[model samples]
Target: MGLYPDDIEAQASAIITTYRDRGWLIATAESCTGGLIAGALTEIAGSSAVVDRGFVTYTNQAKMDLIGVSAATLDAFGAVSKETALQMAHGALMRSGAEVAVAVTGIAGPGGGSAEKPVGLVHLALKTRSGLVDHREMRYGEIGRDQVRLATVRTALEMLAAAAQTPA
Candidate 1:
């Protein structure tokens, strides 16, 4: 009922607390979820201590320009693929002061569904400066656009927390 639901607020709070305690920062590279992941994290007070920046790269050009996702990778794997997600996370990590970064690229829609790449199919990647890169593909299957986006945000928050807890 708030800006973010209770579960999202809890997850965001946990991630922010853990990262801040570890003296770590986080950056987000977001596509279909736009900046919702970043928004959720920053919604918690004292987030400035842990959130470095967020890249809302909703377009291929924006992905390349903002986060350095390679054009070749985009051409080959499409923006929604695990490859682009990894590149986005890696690029965000390399570009920002954050020790941890998470990237999301997906087709969250009522119109962009295909047999191979349907709506609600999301690819997420998390990268740490200490050389850990994790990727996950989620198939939510025709859920509404808002639902898919929110799911991606929740998953991204989970990833960030997991990465922060992992030994660097």
Candidate 2:
């Protein structure tokens, strides 16, 4: 069996097929979801042609150092904010050879939540080298850590598929 559920695998397969057909590559910058998004994409055979790299930037330092997320952005808005998500996407796009990049930053937790940014809150962003950017904020609402991460993976795959299909 694969590492993810059938539904997620289906989405990942679709993404891989779509991008591969277009001769495009993908990169991922993940925080709360860790590298699960990348793992899901790579689960599909032939994904190496479409997926270039994934950054598992679980810490603020890694986000800045690895993907080039600005320290000013992190300090102004916490890691879970939409700003960070966008920057992560931008950074991943800038740093990688991929034409399209996706990023997720969130509090997927049994803990590490606050009044403002609670558990199951995720911010996702997608960027294309052609300058298309899309962002989504999902509040999955107290789902278990594993559930939240899986949900993020599913969403990221969907975004990649959509971006791949969009006319450049």
Candidate 3:
């Protein structure tokens, strides 16, 4: 089974097709979604033509090591913070051949809820090789664990589609 919910398959396919049509490769950096964004894209048959790679940085160390996220950013704002998401997006773009990179980080859980950063609090970022960066903060509320993750994947896919529409 693909990580993408059935409702999102068409969107993912469309984005992948658009990227391929434009000769643009895509990369993803995932944390709470656990690479579902990449999984969704790869589900399309022609994804290999547009999907460069995906970085699954579940742990803070992995984010720093794989995506070159700065220790200072993580320390100052935590993993789910926008600062970290920006770094993750940029890091993925820097490390990959893809021209556009999308990143997601959040707490998708029945646990891990704090007053400030509760469950379903996700941060997403998209960056292009031409130095365009967009960041979105999502508060999906305390929906069920599965629901939160699915919602995050949905949002990321939509953002990916929008990012693909932008000129590289």
Candidate 4:
């Protein structure tokens, strides 16, 4: 079993409430985590005020088309790079008119693990008008795909809360 959606919803609700109190909006660009972050946020009642939008760009092409992630960056560093994550965050902020944005890209797998970029290697990026924050985390090998994605969603919400609390 995985973390329940309601549990994720509760956390997301608290974060959104905090942001709404401060009059800030948030967007998300998700790849390996799929739309789990967005789904968690939207599961909360009255999330419309704080959640601007979510982009589920699971493929290189989708990242380019939806969030304007450059093909060159994807070619150079693959979809899981910090550069791609930053670009995804920046693009979400640029396109969604949100005050803050979080982006995630990673290789979460039982397959698709190069020795360099192993399974469970996740890169997360948070972008605001003021600056950007990025993190690379390896979640102890393959903990199953769902577990990795759930962890990613939780991490993103935590980052969102931190970002919302920051002075703009």
TM-score of each: 0.98, 0.98, 0.96, 0.92
- What are the per-residue Cα lDDT tens digits for candidate 4 across 30-146? 999888888888777788999999999998999999999999999999998889989999999999978899999998887887988988888899999777565555454789888
Look at candidate 4 and tell me the lDDT of residue 142.
84
Better of 2 and 3 by lDDT: 2
The C-alpha stretches of model 2 lying farther than 4 A from their native spots are none
* lDDT of candidate 3 over 34-152, digit per residue (tens): 97888888988889999999999999999999999999999999999999999999999999999999999999989997999999899999999987889999999988888888898
CA lDDT for candidate 1? 0.93
lDDT at position 146, candidate 2: 94
TM-score-wise, the better of 3 and 4 is: 3
Please list the Cα RMSD from the true structure of every candidate, rounded to 1 decimal place.
Answer: 0.8, 0.8, 1.3, 2.1
For model 1, how does the per-residue alpha-carbon lDDT over 89-109 read when each residue is reduced to its tens digit?
A: 999998999999999999999
Q: How close is candidate 3 to the true structure, as a TM-score?
A: 0.96
Q: Residue-pair clashes per candidate, as listed?
A: 0, 0, 0, 0
The reply for model 3, stretches above 4 Å from the true place, is: 1-3
Greater lDDT among 1 and 4 belongs to 1
Q: Candidate 4 clashing pairs? A: none
